[model samples]
Target: MKRTIPPLLTAAALAAGCGTVSTSASSGGGEDAVTVESCGRDVTVDGVPERVVSMHPSLTELLVQLGVGDRVVAQAQDALGEPSPELAAEVDAITSISADVPPTREDLLAQSPDFVISGTEYEFSAEQGFAGYEDLEKAGAPAYVATAGCIDRRSEGAVADTFTDLENLGRIFGVEDRASELVTQAEQDLAEIEEIIGDDDPVRAVQVYVEGGKLYAIGGAVEIDVLRLGGGENLFAGDSRFDDFFAAEVNPEVVVDLQPDAFVFAVNDAAHEEQTRAYLEQTLADTPAVRNGLLVAVDNTYVQPGTLSAITGARIVAEALHG
Candidate 1:
């Protein structure tokens, strides 16, 4: 499978970054101390985390790819989605929690997860349902949130961030080698995409989400950077044009005039796809995307960002635009 890690990044380099830093318990090939840094906080792992409760689907996919699917005692339901045949049984075996929200405090505590991985969008916020970092520690589990889900940060783009997550997970699960392999695959995938788009003028695209009968475009490039990196240009890069901050529901007529080459929609599920279909065939009837029929749906979970999702999402967007 094609992956998204940078080509020059060696396995030794990756393993070194995430491997146990201390040799106190290195009698064999064992890790003595492992730590993962997230949102500027360091989360230490004494040994491999056996009971990991993934609060998000992207994280669940990471576990499956890391070859530690059995370590996942339970995961946020639908986090893995309808698995792609190869992983059907593996995903089916794990218990599902809430699909759209954080599992309740009682529900989460019941699982007794040594590590809790959540998307920063909402689940990371304590008041939303699942407790905060402090709460996770109190419950005997270290809190880990995906950096991709973070707001207002560009220190790491999707590709780099995904690798970071994989490395961190590897550190915790003793799977640095597997993580490295995935990274190599990711690098090749990225190289292929870069070659496809190779110095060509970027294809202008307007990505939006349909909610409550309103059309809302993504405000930040953070989540959609993979698309941009894959050569899809954002029509809303400027603040004065689209106001990515407030993300005001723009008049569909406003978008029709942009005449984007492609229409990217946040179609997380079938319902979202159905919704965007209308936007394509009706609301933007006059645009190039509609006329050319260049409509694409991005899984919301995939948008959340992870090594696998980043690579897969990049490929999905690249195919839709230039396939």
Candidate 2:
């Protein structure tokens, strides 16, 4: 799936300042020039990007939410979930550069994007043959890494941290007003969730994922914060083993030993949900969660960091735990 770097973005092209970047920001009143710290790097966008490449579904959804869906010329093809009704048309309009896989460097360079955004630093891995920041920079595109995706910043991630992405994108696209309104709405929603879970002891839960006959427990990630927002606490929060890993394999014996009140798990579809529940029921039959039928299933995308649906996820978790 790897392709050689396109000749169009070679040293010669870079020397001549050749690329598809627009020279002006949007007509709306926003800073013509904006700089933000993105994944330990200071990235500056010369003007609002008119042609953007979004490397993750969550970030693409965020762009559509910011009212800039028309500017997205290309997007990653791996969809964790279906687009919301509000975003369906826009999501359908953008061309997908890869299918359920990371887009390659040449694939990205061919688009001549004015800007590029990804949910994680992994999208820009040079070793994996994906376009790196320097590659995008050579094409006159500024790369933006979501704050929630930054490894160093995620240890204490909160659902509110989504605000930073919204605000930063607002400034980048001259849609500050739209961003502000969304933030206000999200805050109000979170407040309501808090009110619902008030004065209740937190639910001790473990967020589990089963893949390829292996079991993993989510730890040291924003998923933990989402769990906390819903009045639940992850048993593996701050576990040194997951300080850098999002989720890791665990012995089934550990789940039996911990005796959590509930199991918050992710599922891809209805059939998968049924299968996961049956597996958990059999594997951990004696655990309180299985015995009490306290397993809560969440959509794959909702639990991802910095997603707007994460608010909905927190509410779902709260309802499952408190009610």
Cα RMSD to the true fold for all candidates: 9.1, 7.8
lDDT of each: 0.65, 0.74
Candidate 2 collision pairs: none
lDDT of 2 by residue, 1-323 (tens): 32232110111222223332222212222346788777667778878899999885667788898889899999884444455557767886788897555688999999999899876566676656778777888788888877877645555556677899898899989999999999999999999999889899998899887655667787855677788888997888767767555566789998789899899987655765788898899898888899899999876656665678778778889999996
Model 1 vs. true fold: TM? 0.82
Error of 2 at 10 (Å): 29
Off by over 4 Å in 2: 1-31
Stretches of candidate 1 off by over 4 Å are 1-31, 77-85, 152-157, 240-248
Give the range of the ten consecutive residues with the poorest summed lDDT in model 1: 5-14
